[model samples]
Target: MGSTKHDGDVIILTGASSGIGEVTAWELAKRGYRLVLAARRADDLGQLAGAITQRGGLALPVPTDICVEAQLERLVQMTLDHFGRIDVLINNAGVAKAQDAATPTNPHIDMILGTNLIAPMRLTRAVLSHMIPRRSGHIVNVGSVASYISAPGQAVYNASKHGMRAWNDTLRREMKPLGIKVSLVSPGFIRTPMTETVRGMPMVGPETVARIIAKVITHPQREVITPMAYKFLIALTTAFPGPSDAVMSAWRVWKW
Candidate 1:
């Protein structure tokens, strides 16, 4: 028999307090998926979790700081304890900011890379056992278009995302035969608190990314570059490296 189907299937969403994570949780709740919501703010997570349950959905709020390994381990354990299985893990928490070009300061580089890259890697490792045993699961890593393009002031951010993209690609290959699905969603710029602190950039609303993410989980693929235009851009970039660099350079005139 197939697994129990409900509008309340358990899905653990990191960075659930705001932005893409927030909207994705709401979308999942609408589709009847119970949520294990995580973020640094307990109040925010609690509020979202409560709203979800009040609307006839289910949620377990686990306030988390993904940068810590122990915290991520506990997160996985708690989800397993409550739901018996983790249906999906969305590695959605990350930080990004362009370092000033002239100064080139990187005082917080480790924090950026740790939270954006390492923590998700650790979280994914924590959940793999049950997923591999059951021979089923989905891992969605949120990447950025910057992963494919190299920009001057955004080097660190790109490197972190690039690492994630590469990991997603390799993980898909390693887990395919075991019936696991791994995917990466690289968005250009989503209008969120994370992006709002900066100024003058192309932006898509969080709901837009959330809708695409909801679809991606059920039907898995390698990687997605949203809006269809990115597919063409990536293809074009491959054939002419110098021009691609120029395009990336132009985008940074404002970013820097």
Candidate 2:
């Protein structure tokens, strides 16, 4: 039922210019999703949209900076104006800085929290008014394995992801009664521009993560952690917090 319904579904995807979001747009387009691509890079967004359209998929590029309140509001409004109804909202825009919290720059903290956590929450709120009335919608949050496994030098990044995970979990339970599906995709290391300096990690390609995200939208689930191996790691860390902390602490690559 869910799968069939997702065909030709109207979706708004943030951070659609590159990385996981860009690949996810391609994956969803192939699966028959009509996309509204949002990102700060207008040129990249336009090219991606044009390519999707050339392939007989529907897409519109709306340049957006999710951290800005006005931009986010306009993004939701534009989606509603263009598509009339939005079936899914892919909250994929995020930023990460591998630095210690001890430095404590206001702009850095704001950028991380605003883009990764606050923007998604605000966008979801803006979209929910329309979705709740219709009794149908899906919110798919692209999170990180860092949501579960805390790493050094990623204090702000970890906090944002952990908040995203909590929000997704709570929204899933709340929206169940409203007939809305909330899903979270927590991927481990993925090869992207943001992770270019991260070497020798167990990384999956963006396309793989995108495919999983597409599947999650069609067949809704509460959460999914990519690469599968991370699932066991999550369990191990959860059951033995002290040893897990010790291991992560000793891992020099993850240190600042």
Candidate 3:
């Protein structure tokens, strides 16, 4: 059944306190999906949940640190206990510790890899068993343009996203026969707290991404690149890595 057949299509969204995740929650809630919001900030999660509830929807805030395996386990258990089954898992929680790779300590590496890569793997594993038996579910992995185009000061972040895309691709093929759909939503830079310091770059708003994500949930696809323009950029960069690298190198030195 399509996601629109929602009287209680339970969805668990991570990184839901702000940015794309936040807006996506509103979009899905308005469409009748029951939400289980997870994030590190309890106050923000509660506020967003309250706002959704005020809008005459079902949203339960489960303040969670996705980096913590125990917390992630608790989150899935809570959602299942409350909603009975998870129709969708939106792995939106991600972190970017952009700096020169040489200076990264173990903690920095762990933090980036843990939140951006390991967390999703674990969360997906937790929900896989549930979705597999039913043989019907969706997993949306939110990635970035960096997954295709690499640049300076984003070595770890780039690695994490590339890893996400790899996992999403493999899982997509593996789960196709089981009726499980996996989608990777890769977007160019978005105007969010995470990218506030990135000036002079074209950035789409979070809602733009949320809309694409909402559409993908209903009409599932293997992958989606928002704004449609990034698809060309990604194609060019992938086809001509040498020239792409040179151009990106020059971009790092360009004066704003």
Candidate 4:
């Protein structure tokens, strides 16, 4: 897959209206990849597509609530209808809410897991219907450091990301034999609206992650942790759970 040429490749990008997805859309479009943008915000999605088209890039905005199974199907159908083929699927749409796991209502649990975990799984299955037949495509799941380190006050979010990481690893093996590449781009704290209120961590702009996603599409690695430093943190935490637990306790005190 590394040697595969990407000229005029059609990529479906979810959560394109903001954050990493928004920046990634621009990055991929600049690299000459045809894009199908999907998000719940119709106006923002349309504006983004229009902006890309104005700059001589191919973009089709498909407003979709990824949580809805039907909309996920429609998004893929629309992309195939417009572009004739889907070369890449970037599952970037996600949501997080900081609250006590015991206090969260069922809706809260559903929203977090639905958007961050289940939606991607279902969307990937929908896209695979097409990619499997061609035996040529790439699936990039945007995950979080939370997948590895479960911080305080974010239990459900941590669970969602953890599930995502597991899914990505197994899916990569399953798709490998079929010639479809699966990659996970996990990042530490990022300077997006999603993390604006977060503190006590070094943060990078979403563009940094966006560039990595674009590169992964061509180079194709199994998993990539951005900023590189987080890889060491994840290793240390996994090796010494007691210290990680103490730090998480301190974070809980400081946060709440």
Candidate 5:
């Protein structure tokens, strides 16, 4: 009861222009999900929607920037107007990496926090107003292994994921009685466009991660981990803190 469970379900996905988000949207469509795709790149989103339609899937492209509340609200509003209700909202539009004082121009801290942390929370808030009354909905916040095993060179990215993790954990308790499921999916390494930017790491394909995400949403799990091996790694790290910390430190991947 993974993707197939979503047949006829109205789903909203962000970061649909490329990477994991794009592949997830496609995966859900193949499983018969009526989709609403959102991204900052309108052209990319349009092409994506068109591609899905070409494959005989139902989808709509909405230009949106997660950093902005208005755009996010519009995304939620349009989904409701177009599909009448949103059964699932995939918060897959967050940043994966970032900078620190090791460099002079460490990019804009505000932008990192804004896009990676603030936006997803706002989207959750907006979606809940509608979801609560229906008493049935699912929210999947696409996170990373970085959320728990965070490191240096990506401070804000880790913080944002940690925030999402905490928020979802609490929200799970709050919404469980209301019939809304909250899921936080943390994938290890997936070969999306972002994977290319990652330094010195083997990668998993976007389609692979998308499949797991679809599975989690349909089955309503508290957590979904991809590639399988990462689960053992997480357990190992949790068990032997001394060795785990030493290895990550040696690699210069300071756990955050």
Candidate 6:
């Protein structure tokens, strides 16, 4: 779990087409880690892979819809086929919709939970079959501050992230003795294409997250909240839920 040399380590990364995943892929590749990139956008995934290969890094793009169990299985199989082993799995694919809890369509709700929560759990299970026998691997889940702080308009997103946080924590404990490390990297609002329309919140670039992920791969931890300041916010909110809820409610109305 803690190694400085990643010369030929195989890392399977979901959501590798853009944002945090793409950035993290490049960061890991720079550290000499062979990468198996998974994402629904084939063109983008291929392009990213090509770019990495051009830069003299080992990368394989496996276009995948992580929501589908068959696709997730295929992804794991392909990684094993090409790399012959899986060293790490970064579950980064996620989707979100800012809508009232009752107003959002069923498909939207399914998409949010399926991509953010269910898929990661399923994919991790598939990868574990291989990792457990080897007694070595790492699973880093990309979560959000929404997991700890709830906002009115983002009910579904909040739920999905909260579920992810729970899963990550429980899995970390379970994997500790198995020699498989599990970590959760929760970031505040980030400046990604996904958050282009988001406003009035401090945001960090995807590179900041990418670097943290690379570091976590080398030195695993239970959970990390980036920008450091959010740690204080989470502590404050946890201590005073009523005031926090009132502030979030006001912010939701302001956005409206």
Instruction: Give TM per candidate.
Output: 0.90, 0.95, 0.95, 0.96, 0.91, 0.96
Error of 4 at 237 (Å): 0.7
Better TM-score candidate (5, 6): 6
Would you list the C-alpha lDDT of every candidate in the order shown? 0.82, 0.89, 0.89, 0.91, 0.83, 0.90
Ranking by lDDT: 4, 6, 2, 3, 5, 1
- Number of clashing residue pairs in every model? 3, 0, 0, 0, 3, 0
User: 1-256, model 3: which lDDT tens digit per residue?
Assistant: 1236655789999999998899999989988899999999999999999999998889999999998999999999999999899999999998876677578778888999899899999999999889999999999999988888887777888899999999999999999999999999998888888887776878789999998888898889888888688889989998998998888877751122
Model 2: CA > 4 A from native: 1-5, 252-256
TM-score, candidate 5, is 0.91
RMSD of each: 3.1, 2.3, 2.5, 2.6, 2.9, 2.4
lDDT of 1 by residue, 8-47 (tens): 4578899999989999888888877778999999999999
List candidate 3 stretches off by more than 4 Å.
1-3, 253-256
* Per-residue alpha-carbon lDDT of candidate 2 for residues 14-43, written as tens digits (9 for 90 to 100): 999999999999888887888999999999
- Candidate 6, which ten residues in sequence have the lowest lDDT sum? 247-256
Regions of model 6 farther than 4 Å from truth: 1-4, 253-256
**Considering only N, C-alpha and C atoms within 3 Å, which residue pairs clash in candidate 4?**
none
Native-vs-model 5 lDDT? Answer: 0.83
Instruction: Give model 3 RMSD, 1 decimal.
Output: 2.5
